[model samples]
Target: MNLKLQQYINGKWVEANSGNTRTIINPFNQEVIASVPEGDESDAKAAIAAAREAFDNGEWASTPATERGAIVRKIAEFIERDKEELAHLESLDTGKTVEESRGDMDDIAGVFRYFAELADKDGGELIDSPVPNSISKVVREPVGVCGQITPWNYPLLQASWKLAPALATGNTLIIKPSEITPLTHIKVFELMEEAGVPAGVANLVLGAGDTIGAELSSNTDVDLISFTGGIVTGKKIMQAASVNVKKLALELGGKNPNVIFADADFDIAVDQALNGVFFHAGQICSAGTRLIVEESIHDKFVNALVERVKKFKLGSGFNEDTQMGPLISAEHLAKVEKYVEAGVQEGATVAVGGKRPEDPELQKGFFYLPTIFTDCTTDMSVVQDEGFGPIITVEKFRTEEEAVNLSNDSIYGLAGGVFTNDIAKAERCAAKMRMGTVWINEFNLYFPHAPWGGYKQSGIGRELGKLGMEEYTETKHIFQNLKPETLNWF
Candidate 1:
């Protein structure tokens, strides 16, 4: 694949002002795939200026809502047309299986199509007028320039979450995809441009968060900042976005919990538990890394998980039989290692995997064995911290109340799952869990129609659904007097 080696700024593909580049590596084999421009604050500033100018000039904001929707829908069509290529790029860049990347491409297209259909659904609402001979209505308008920062875990998928809504609502945006995994994002930008998006309406800046991302957050010209990443970086962005009091939407990583009751279908619960954390090698923001198992079945459940994990085929994402791929990079692998060591220090017993695999075939890549810690407490750092790896900390719970409490015992409340055969008990637990999304008898399932976000430090605003589109718009209460009957009182 021929990489687009420049940044998309101000309606033109251009190089970084400093003329520097960063090597794009395929994490599975540590091979350099391409070199992309290493953008800085200046490149971000230029992109922001372009977006602001385009918004102020009404280049995109003035377009009819249905027209914008059509263009956005076209982007979805383009994604479909190029889904296979996009999936290949995504797999190569992020080290996720090609099959998983194909699924993401499908979901990404669905997200764009969802927002496209929703774009013109609500022009505004007519309000009942309280005053005589008066007209009152509430209309939604574009929020001007927006800055979107997406994470590496699902590069194009996360970008679609931000881009489709922003564009559908007539807002201009500068999207900064994770520098490590930008291949699919760049390709999607090409698709958007081909879909008839005006040049400055959507911009792409490639670089690290400290430079390019900082400008997007701190710049006063930006009206909104939507970021998906770690809590530490999310907090820093919140502080920086206060410069102009820009509207913020954040999806910080979560140490999500998966509570399995003893009464749940034994085989299904065990299967879903592994499905929750092992997908993408547990790099997901909503990964079910914390397992709260009922005490009665704790030992049995751990044994089942260990057996299945032992048989997982670890290899290249392109391999059809590979169950899981390597982590994104060596640095991330080390972080997971450190987390495992810390878990051991905190008195958590490593039930299955506590170190990298000794397989010589996997040595060239960053591979860690699927790990499970048995004697984990809620207070253990392994349970509290978002390890973002292929590790699960199993904590025992005696009662339903104890399970709920243990699941909610975290600084992050993005998402969690409850596995049970009892419908009433499942509803009860779902209602009690303090999370943005709770799954019953399932895990890691999401769609474009439903809203996604968190309860606490996980995030500030919702994405997807109608609320996602609303995030890119501002409400205006327009009141007009039909008849001139004003009292001349000062």
Candidate 2:
């Protein structure tokens, strides 16, 4: 089937600014699945203008919050009704398993529903005033226009995380999705139209990060800039937003650690560790790529992990037996391979899969074998940086203090996971970890009602919670006189 594509700006489907086009290749098959309108700076300007006008003058911002929420909920309904088609498009466009894409679809729908449910629930709170016969209250107002930049891993889901809350709170948005996987977002724009989001309220612009992304970050008309991607690009976005000092929310890269205590449930730890890094082909930002296992049980844990890793089926995302899909692109696959090579040369041991699948059918794809390396050191690049793929380098820790130190050693503090049966130990681990989100026994799980962001270089601000909606809002204090005036300091 031939795929149809267009850029959504001013709530209309339009061609690229210069009619330049690019073929979006499916990483799983290395096939040109679709042709997308290659956009640039001019398209970026058009989108920002539409969203700015809508927020500044259109009825969208002035509409009741409850009604605005109803529109978001309608978008959720559209997502549910079109899950199969969107999931397929996502798999084709992003090289994810159909199963993974379907899960992402559910996440997208849930995000919209959660934010929609919160639409009309807010009201002003009364407080005592310092002055004689006076009352005061506080109000939350939308922060004009928002510029949302999403990464390639979770296209539709990440977009919903930003778009739903911003819209639910009556803020218009301009979305710049990763150019590599723009198909799902195009589909999302269609659903927004079906949900009756007014023209100029939500707009989609496609282009390289250097051209359009920079403009979105620095656009004086944009009030908030929310982004999710790498630390390098996050830094670039930060520099751009500094031009206007716009409210910034970033969910950047993570070298999250998965701690396995000696007395803990080793089986569960192994499985969660695998899920943490291998899921999404390990393209996630918060992947538990650093496995900090305590000694005395490291050998047994590694053996069990190898057996489980071997049983994982490698194939197309369309197949039910495939446990993990390909990486996002060939360039990413090569980077992962180079990391594995470094792990070997730096004295780490590969305990399981390290090379790509040998099957000819999989040869054409950007596939990489899920790799597990033991005896990994803290200084090694594989252990230090974000692998951003299906590779884990295991390192052993002795004392509790050492474990904490090792986990917190990295520049990134996005997320960390501690697997322990003892409540005290888990709580202590949670307290010591410097990350924004500390998973007691879970990994890579998020809800729209919880704030999602990272500490340190992992990025700033938050997303996906009550706090997330507030990211696009500004608080205003109001004072009123209830009685005749009183004398104050002259």
- Report the C-alpha lDDT of model 2 over 318-382, residue by residue, as the tens digit: 88878888888989888989988888899989998889989888988888888899989899998
Candidate 1 per-residue lDDT over residues 347-374, each given as its tens digit: 9999888898898888989899999998
Candidate with maximal lDDT: 1
Off by over 4 Å in 2: 1-4, 482-490
Model 2 residue 63 CA deviation in Å: 0.5
Which pairs of residues collide in model 2?
none
lDDT of each: 0.93, 0.88
TM-score of each: 0.99, 0.97
| Span of 10 residues, lowest total lDDT, candidate 1 | 2-11
Instruction: Tell me model 2's lDDT, rounded to 2 decimals.
Output: 0.88
Highest-TM-score candidate: 1
